[model samples]
Target: MGNTTEVTFFILAAYGDHGQIKYLYFSCLLLLYITICLANIILISLIYVDRSLHEPMYVFLCSLFMNELHGSTTFFSVLLLHILADTHEIAIAYCNVQSFFLHAYGTTEMYNLAVMAYDRYLSICHPLHYSSRMNSCKMYSLIVFTWSFAFFKFVIPMSLRLQLPLCGNIIDKLYCANYALVRLSCQNISLNNILGVFSLVLSVAVPLIPILFSYVNIVRICYKSPKEAQVKALNTCTPQVISLLYFSVSGFFEMVETQFDLTYVPQLIRNVCMVYLFACPQILNPVMYGVRLTKIRNAFKKRFFPNSTE
Candidate 1:
């Protein structure tokens, strides 16, 4: 047999065949997609227009919102179309492309969060050196590194995946993931599995370990500092900690569901858990930042309702 596999399209099993409830599903998805767009766009605009908000933390926040937009758009734009179509199938080439972007999104978000954690650690734990440590040049370099690292990490595994002879053309999820695509391969995927595991570790562990370490130091410093300093640190870092917690929990559940037999669980519940992995971060990041961070909230107020005073 030739090394090349001939697969034309993929049917997504997660796309429910709800004859009467399809409209409801479409409406809900449309509403969600719109909300994500609006939140990210507004947050991005808030940062851009306000000159005071051009600092490193806000810059990272802006990047995070943009990543959320990219990730959601990658999944939902195709998803919304699939929802309306009679047959829920995606072309193989397009599926591969989507999988790459989505994986890029996941890795990029993790690195971005790790950067944010480092920023907070400097500001809170080493206030005196924070300015010199996270300067403009350094900040830009970190941002570039975040994107570059995520892109290269997936490119290798993705290229390897595309060469596999897929035994099946159906994915059991709403969207294409590298592993999901790899699981469909017919040939021995030992190499693919090894690469996949390595990719997952590099993507998740590399960024996450640093984040945890930063927070540990931050907490230790908070304990040693004065009451006022502790409060200030909490105020600035609470939203980020919350965002990290949400990502960790949601991501863990998704990974567990993927690895184990969750067939005993109701399809609706399982489906909700699966989509929440994608949806929660997009929704939670902006809202959590907007509400918890006083600067962003104030920026929004000043730009939109300058006349109001609390």
Candidate 2:
């Protein structure tokens, strides 16, 4: 980051081409991508087609699944291409686009989870006013707010990164990351550093406050309620709490990979860690919800296998 160089394109040196092994990696990623697509698509279909799922919470879930599909495609498609290609170069403009969407993908997911927690809180803590409070208008507003706010929050970082003069053109990972690009800057990056911390608060940490508050209230209410009520709360909240924790762990891996020194670790392990940051959530969320949530499972059956008795 000392010498100035105007980098037009970036080489993704992290992609290891071990000849035949590339094919194996390609196949595995292809299979994983297909699974991610199918699982999320099925979840989205069930939510949209089943009138019983027209509620605000399910609608939020549909949005979350749609975002999963978008994120998976953005990641897997380019990765599959690079795995098969002879060169691992990405044009600067395209890299910027990918960086923006990928970052936005992560931030949007946290926001979606935050809103889902609020919906769950409203459902468990104030059932009598849930309908009025989480009306169609307000629900849609929250959904829109999540997406818009995420994209808006990430734009500042992307814009700051664009103005930087890169001292290097090689990204150490399979994908272009905003912070990685910032690390390549030849100039003083104190502003980017300051903004990075500020954006982390706005994009990641701030949303968690509300989500935690919502869950705490739910827990307090369930503690004082009947045994059946506690069971109902767990039944409704289990998938989301698991999803939130899963994503948090994945995000932690990402934060460590970017912020810490991982050069000593084997490349395969690092790559696996990076892949888990996004892929695990996409695959696990839908599968967990599909299998564990009776309403979703029954609705899926009623929609696809009508011969089965409900």
Candidate 3:
């Protein structure tokens, strides 16, 4: 083999079996991908088309659903292709592309949730100032920052990997990840590890702190407010809290799997966990918002069933 530059492809070692079980796996994943796309698209359309739903909260929800769709497509599309084909190899350049988008999606999503938490905090804790504080300019600024911050976080690590000669090209996972790719580098990866940790904090902890803080203030305010105010705040805040918990738990599992060896876990169980970690959030997020948020539900019903009273 020529110097590390000659390597052109990588073997993804975590593909499902080549036997009969592959079809069952393929069928399940295909259904999941379709549902995720349809659900997110419908939500985005509803928000865009309905003038009444065009507020800060719904705008944020639309962006959140779009991010979910982007992330899911990056993972599930590549995965479905490999499942259908006999070979599970990916070109180096495209692998980097996938890593970039998936990482960005994860970070952006966390930031979106944090922004939602902030919005909720203002609406409930400081209703008098909510309208002025969350103007169009501020909303655009938050959305832009979430995308830009997440984009650059992965770019540095990816550029670093590109310069270093890879020692091997075998990635033992379903999809490409910055950490996984860096692990295959031939040179010392201290810098990469440091930056990876930095990215993790930026992606997960940065958004998480705001969510926790906002909720803390919200809880305090609700406690001191009247019974009616308490009920209203609780209904409004429940969806965001649920979304936060779901993402947190799933992100935790992903971190553990990446940092530690899980060889002892049964292969089937591990596979299920891996698939669910990514798929569940994309599928459930829209459902959580759609069913729980009365404004969205009533709007959806009205738009789809204009004539029916029930």
Question: Over 4 Å off in model 3, which ranges?
Answer: 1-5
lDDT of 3 by residue, 7-123 (tens): 698888888567877888799899999999999999999999999998999999998999999899999878888887788899988898898998898899899999999999999
Q: TM-score, each model? A: 0.96, 0.97, 0.96
> Model 3: which residue pairs collide?
none
Report lDDT (Cα) of residue 156, candidate 3.
Answer: 82
Residue pairs whose backbone atoms clash in candidate 1: none
Cα lDDT of model 1 by residue, 36-83, tens digit: 999999999999889999999999999899999988899887878877
TM-score for candidate 1, residues paired by index: 0.96
The top-ranked prediction according to lDDT is 2
Candidate 1: global Cα-lDDT? Answer: 0.86
Query: What are the C-alpha RMSDs, in order, of all predicted structures?
Result: 1.8, 1.1, 1.9
Query: lDDT (0-100) at residue 162 of candidate 3?
Result: 79
Ranking by lDDT: 2, 3, 1
Q: What's model 3's lDDT at 230?
A: 97
Q: In lDDT terms, how accurate is model 2?
A: 0.89
Against the reference, the lDDT scores of all candidates come to 0.86, 0.89, 0.87
